[model samples]
Each structure stands twice: as structure tokens, then as C-alpha cells.
Target: MRAFLRVAAPLLVLSAPAFGQGGPSPALIGRGRILATAADCVACHTVEGQPAFAGGKAIATPFGTIHAPNITPDRETGIGAWSDAEFLRALHDGVGRAGEQLYPAFPYVQYTRLSDADVLAIKAYLFSLPPVRRTAPANDMLFPFGYRPLLRVWKWINFTPGRFAPEPGRGGEYNRGRYLAEALGHCNECHTPRTLTQGLDMSRNLAGGIVEGWQAFNITPDPVSGIGRWSREDIVTYLSSGRLPGRAVAGGPMGEVVGHSLRFLPREDLSAIAAYLEGQKPLRNPGDTAPRSGYGRPDPDRLSFSLGGNGLPTGRGLYVAACASCHGLDGRGTASVPGRPGFPGLVGNSALGAARADNAVLAIIHGVPARGGRGESFMPAFGAASRIGNALDDAQIALVANYVRAQFGNAAGSPVDATSVRRLRLENGGRSPLVVGVWAGMALIAGLAILFAARLVRRRARGNGAERMP
Candidate 1:
């Protein structure tokens, strides 16, 4: 599961009594298809290599794994039985077929802002797909989160079921962009930091947050920390194709979003999204001195990869052995045709230039997956057993991350240690110490309460027996 989906899973769990047997119009179904794509429906609803929207992907969280439910109109196990009203309620109110509260992992909090017509159109499009009879495995949520009814309290505190309202005097482009980004794309759900309860903190919208150990860098208009310097075209190109040469390249969850959703949208709609983001409030993150991609320069003379007596590779040696081919010895990318895409360069690359070395470390561990469009791009994984070569250990990854950052990123003085790499390696699903502590405390309390109740029951039984004997 993507980091964003870690907080949100089992989204669009639509079901209810079937609507009339009459089929919807072809035009409506086509329109619904586009709307669903805009909303990135298939990404969550379908498991890879499975029937689209058949939904059996296990979404992992701190609580447990949530398997995405079938939404392929299967009469027995999917949304084929769902009425239009039921579908609308699921998206807009976070309610399931039997009036059960849907988990926040579904992002109904943002989906609620979708207009009724749009919501129905998505349902129509889903119903048009071929029905698969596979039932999703049951969710394995732990303790309190598994209790669906308790979501009532979460909704009460965080949710507001309402349709999107366009700002008065705002141009069509801005309003349309806002609607797509907020209601459909749900951008802030990942980009914005979460509250203690795991709800989106609107106050820091697009200021950037970590997802799956990768930084979902700030998209706000702040000049120092965000994309304020990026032209509207840069935004469009990056969103549509997932890379911007020397500036940025989509990785991790954001990469998935581009590959699955953004590239499919028409150029005009992408432009609208860019225009809207350009006008957002500029908020600077603490300690951000310049743009993440503003540091590092190509220097061919810096290459030095000497090995020690123990045959251990130094940081530079590891990078040279693993990365020098694609990202050149000079930290510039390998050369390609004049107008064709080439390997992404290390100098001024966002991943290497961030304050924290999490993204850099993770990229080395997981490797960048191949992305389609604008020519194929990929990196080999060195984690566990390497696909291309010997697997890099945790200490090696930390060394590489630090070396890459010092040579190509904004933070030369600050380095990521092996312990941080180990944490990201073992538990990169955003489980902070505070969250673990809270869970531990709750478990302890529950155990103590159970013990107290058992002791009380034993005492009561003994007293009753004594009274009977008398």
C-alpha cells in the first residue's frame, strides 16, 4: 500500500439494493469513466494483474491490513447490487450498505465535497465494467480501529459532509482546478500533515509530509521550500509525466499517482490544476533555506572510489559501483540524444537534495520502479538480495545516502545514520514513537482492566458460596 493509503484504505466500499434493471446511456458511462480516472479509482480498487476493480489488494497500516473490496459490479460481492443512492451515500457520507461507518482510509472526508452528479457518474462508470465474482478478504484492523461504529466519533470530530463550493469571483480555471485537486485528486490528503487523530491538517495544506518514508515535498507557493519558482508548465509536465529533468522526479507513492492517474488526464485539465496550485498560500517549513533541487553541481573531478584492506567499499566506492553508470561519475546523468529523455541526473535532484536523507536511503533500498511515458525510466533495487548485483546492507545504504546528499543535495553537514536507515528498513509505514507508545499504553490498560474484572468476579463467587453455606 502507498503511504497515503496507509492512513486511508478500503475506500469506495459501495453496496446496497440493486437499482432498476435498465442500463445507463453509453455517453453517461463514458463520462463516468473519465470522472473515475480523474478520481484515481482503479489504483485502490484493483489489485495488480487482477481484474480491474475486482479489489483484493491488502492495504497495510499500523492497525492492520485492509483488503480493498470488489467494486466491479459483481452482484454477489461487488457494487452491482448498489443503488444510486447507496453509492452516493458511500462517497459523500462515508456510510456503507448497512449504514456502517466507513473507515477514514477511504478519504470520504474529501470525497464528500464531490458533487452528486459527479459521484453518480463515477458509480455509473464502475457498473459499466465487467463484473468479477471475487470477494475481497476480510479486513484485519486491530483493536479500536477495527470497530467500525467508533468511526462515528472520528467523523464527528473531523468530517463535514458537504459539496464543493466555488469561491465567488474566482475564475473558471481556478475553481475547476480547486475542484479537481481537492475533491477528485485529494492532493492535500497526502501532502498535508495529519493531526494527532490522523485527520488532514488543512492549516498546513501542501506544506509537504512524509509518505511511505518518502518526502511528499511541499507543493505550496513558498519560494524557499515549495514550488513557487516552478512555472505553470513545470507543474503540468511533472504531474502528467512524473519528471522535470534537473528539478524533480516522481518516486514512491507520488510516482504511482502520476503513472496511474495524472498522465491520463487531458492537457487542459492538467493546466487548470497547475494554475490553481500556483495561487495557493505560501507556507515555509522550518529550516528550509532553499528549494530542495537548488543544491549540488556536476564535478567530474570528485570521483574517488578506493577500497579498504577488508575489501569494504567506501561511500564513494558504493555509489561508483552501483550508480555511476546511470548517474555519471560527475554526478550528472548519462548522456542521451539531444531531444530524448536520459537517465535522471544526481545534481539538483529533489530526492538527494532534501534536508532528511529518507528518500535517498529508500530509493537505494527499494530502487526506482520503471515509469511509462516520456520514455521508460528505472533503477535497480539493492535491498535484500540485489536484482542487478550484491544487496547493499543497512550501513551501506546510510553511507550512500549521506554521500549522495553531501555531493548532490542541500544537507552536507547533516547526515542520516544507520539507525535511521534500519528504522526505515524495518518499519517505514510512518509508525512514530508516540504512536507506538500510545498503543503500548492502551494495551497495558486493557490487560490491567481484564485482570481487575477477573479478580472481582472470583471474590463475588466466593462470597455468594459462603452465604449459601450459612
Candidate 2:
């Protein structure tokens, strides 16, 4: 009877209803929707022109490409077949259905901190989406790393499974902010630098790291290299709209984050994030002694023009012709007219002031699209396919970018070259040499273990033979 009950118990649990068995309550589904938005699941899961959550987006990592799986409710290709236990396991343990270990690229490390209730809520929300029958492309990872079983070792070393608990004596706002920033938002995944093993270096949390070829600027409270100088209002404004005049504008991944995710967040939630960020310890990059400064004024002599024999416009001439109309010859932006806000000032702009010139080059190549609730002022792209601006080649774009940096950004001696422009234009993904080294080290350890095991076996066999002879 005991044995029968045990077997029956297992069957009963399997047959039990999952989170959204007979359709979740409207309030529960709404909560789940909010959580999903906060998590920005759509950003990673959805491909352009495809049904939401019917994933085919390719997330590039230092190791390889990880194609996001369909999360739509399709029984064959999406999460429709996933049980509550299976879905929760994916969130809490980073394990997929069929007991397959999921890659960290899915950020299960952060999701692991979510409570059971939260996980179920998210699952319920996902199940509410119209199921699409689509399968994502397979991951294109390099050798050894490509082996999914290797993730077991990776998880064992880096992953710590648990739910987030609020710190004692902290205000509600602070705690809420911590949960949102660390768990729901997974801000550290990109903002914080990775260890040699590609784990988050929590010791230097939010001090800044590179992602996708663009600098994820430091958000720590350090006055020199971080956001220490930013007011809470500044942070909120930036988060709400993705722009802060005279400070910075969002681009690349950040732009997408703003346009799609952050801008939609409520004011109180934005405030919470700002509060949490402000409370963090000030961290600065190595050798960053002082705050960055903008160039006071552009020198007239520096704007001298000299055309190439090929009749291509000189850097100064190009700026004068292509840029100076809106951004005056003096490099100060023109005043707003009846409809437009005119051009943004180049001097002291964050993109121009950055240590690396990639952002500046990207802006010149791709141009700033109209974003947020901001009116229709837009910067036309100068790349090959630009409809408004001259379809300048790599050399011309580099020339204009370097000239702006030197004259308006005080980066006079350090110039961006054609080669750098070409590279940035072609390669938007950053490489991870550390990931390669980790794989190599793992191989070495495995080899040594095998050799040691063989020696032990040989010694045991010899001992057994000696015993028989004796």
C-alpha cells in the first residue's frame, strides 16, 4: 500500500495544474505582464517583424551566438508544452525542459533570485501570449564551449541559486530599487565587468563594462568616472527619456533599452532605480584621477580646409558643408526655431568626450533617430545608405568625426583613423579573449585529470598482479 501511494503521488503531482491551468486571473496576468516588461524579455526574445516572444534574435557573446528560444505558447516550438515545474526550473535553476542546462546568456543567474510567486506570474503572463509555431536557429558556439554539457561545469563554478531577500533596516524604496536593478532588470549583467570566468565581478558592481562594442558607461557614484555628479533628477530624466542635455544621449543597446523599456517605466520606479544607484559605493576605473572636461572653444585656425587631389572634401570643409549649418561654424549649436530644437551642442557632449571614439563614429554613421517624447528633430545618417546626408565613405566619416572630436571635444592629438571607422562600421560585437582562455584552462585541467586517472589505474593493476604472484 505504501509503495502504491508513492507511485500514485508522483502521478498526481505530474497531473496537477500549472500556473495558468484554466487561465490565470486578470490581475495575476497583469502583474506578470508588468514583471515581463521590467525584465525586458521582449528585447532579447523577439525578432523584428516577428510575433512577440516567438524568438529568433541572435545574442552575440564573446564565446558565440546564442539564439533566443521561442517563448510563445506553441505546443511544438514554444513554451506551450512547458509545465509549471519546467518553467520554474528554467527561471530558478537555468535548466530547460528535458533537463538540458541553459546557457548564462539567458541570465538565469539573475532570474534565480526571483521568488516562486514571481516566476509563476511571469510564466502565466507568457502563457497568455498567442502561441506561434516557430523554432529559433541553433546556437553557433565555438568548440568545447559549443558543448552544452560544458555549462554544467560553468554553472557549478559561477552560479549560486537563491531568491532575493531585502536587507534589514533599508527603506522600502531602496529595497524595491535593489530588487528591480539586481533581479528584474539584471542591470549588472551588462553594466558590471565580468571575471576571468565570465562571472559578474560583484566587488566592482556597476563600475562599467563594454557590451556589444559600445561602452556601457559607469553608473557608480564615483565623481570622476561615474555618475556621482548626477542628481537624482538627472538620473530619472535620463531613464525616462534616454537623454540629458549637455550630459549624454543614449545610443546602441542603451538606445534600445530606453526606447523600448525604460521610457515606459513609471516615475516612482524610475526614482527607485535612481535612489538605489545613488546609494551604491563610488567606484572608478583604474588611473581615472579626474573628471572629464569639455573644450572651451574651437580655434579658428583649426578649422582650416585642405581638399585631397581626388576632390574629396577636407575634414573641416566637410563639417562646414554637412554639419555647420545647424551646429554653427563655431561648433556651438544653433537656437531652436519655430518647430525644431535645432542641433544638439557638440562641445561637452558625452559621445564626443568619451575616451574611445566609437560612439562618435557610430553617431556620424548611423545618426540619431528621433526618440522618446521629444519632438521630430533628427540627425540624418552619413553612412552609405543615408537618404538625407552625403553617403560619405569610411574615410570621409572618420575625417568629420576626428575633426569634431579635436575641435569641440579637446581630443586634438588623438584622431580616429579610417581603419578604426571601418572596423566599428563592420564589427558591432565585442570579442572575449578571456572566454577563450577559460575554455583552454578547462581543457588543460581535464587532460591532467585523465592522465592522473590512467596512472592510478595502471598502479592498481600492477599491485593486483603482484598480489597474485605472491
Which of the numbered candidates is closest to the native, going by highest TM-score? Answer: 1
Q: Each model's TM-score, in the order given?
A: 0.86, 0.85
**lDDT over C-alpha atoms for residue 376 of model 1:** 73
Candidate 2 least-lDDT 10 residues: 4-13
Q: What digit string (tens of lDDT, one per residue) describes model 1 on residues 1-470? A: 12211111122212322233576666556666777777887878888888999988876555556788899988999989988889999999999998998887787988998877677767878888889999999998666567777678678888999988887887877877888899889998779987766677889999997665677889999988899999999999999888898988887778888978888887777887898899899999998887888998775565577586788887778888888888888888976766655788989998777778777788888877766665676877787685486788888888788877888877564687778888886546545454556765765675578679999999999999999994
Please provide the root mean square deviation of candidate 1 (C-alpha atoms, Å): 6.7
Which digits, one per residue and each the tens of the lDDT, describe model 2 over residues 119-206?
7877888988888999999988766567678788789888999988877877767767777788888999989998877889989999
Against the true structure, candidate 1 reaches a TM-score of 0.86
Q: What is the overall TM-score of model 2 with all chains considered together?
A: 0.85
Q: Name model 2 segments beyond 4 Å from true.
A: 1-22, 293-311, 324-329, 334-342, 372-376, 410-414, 430-470
* Steric overlap count per candidate: 2, 0
Best candidate, lDDT: 1
Give the 10-residue window scoring lowest on summed lDDT in candidate 1. Answer: 1-10
